[model samples]
Target: MFVETEEFAKRLEAMDGLEREAAYEAVVRWFAENSGRITHHMHLAPAHTATTVRLGGGEPIVTDGPFVEGKEVVSGYAEVEVADLDEALKMARSWPACPIVEIRPVA
Candidate 1:
């Protein structure tokens, strides 16, 4: 149940108005309705820099860039313990905002 997007991340950080409160309530209600199967929900912040690194005998070299660029970047994720991916997908489909959901198993 990972909601991944920079836009969403920004919204979460600045949720302080009436509309934001309503939106938060709606999301909470949705989660509450499906609380029976959700064990937890977590958010992850993505690094904006490239992860590629070069190792050499002389010195360690680092690159200043990201692996890829796109209009929508993964800002965070949510972890949901469910029966399976199908159940997770169903829950994700019910999300009111940010239609994108990245489902992955916890290690």
Candidate 2:
């Protein structure tokens, strides 16, 4: 949902229609292949308009935006269950998004 660089915009524009479709198809294929292992999935809206809500011992405190200001914010979530941490790491690594994917176990 987000990219940090102005250069990325130029690169994105260079992608032709078929290339864009192929990239999307590839991602869809990955999801289909791993569907059995995926426990939960969610797609979130763009983060810019996100509202941050909190409570400080009284009434609910609502803010106009994200918890932190940055080009990088958690835009969505996926929950997967693998054999172990190593397996989880392998799955995360296989994602096309690569380094952008963060795997945190629920406590």
Q: Which candidate achieves the best lDDT against the true structure?
A: 2
What tens digits encode model 2's per-residue C-alpha lDDT throughout 1-107? 21223344345578899977886687678788889998877766655688988888699888887777765566567788788989877776676532366777788
TM-score of 1: 0.57
Candidate 1 runs further than 4 Å off: 1-16, 44-68
Tens-place lDDT digits, model 1, residues 1-107: 44346777687678778878888788789778888877766544465644646677578766765444554655445557788878888888887666577778889
What ranges in model 2 sit over 4 Å off? 1-16, 57-59
What TM-score does model 2 achieve against the real structure? 0.76
The estimated TM-scores of all candidates read 0.57, 0.76
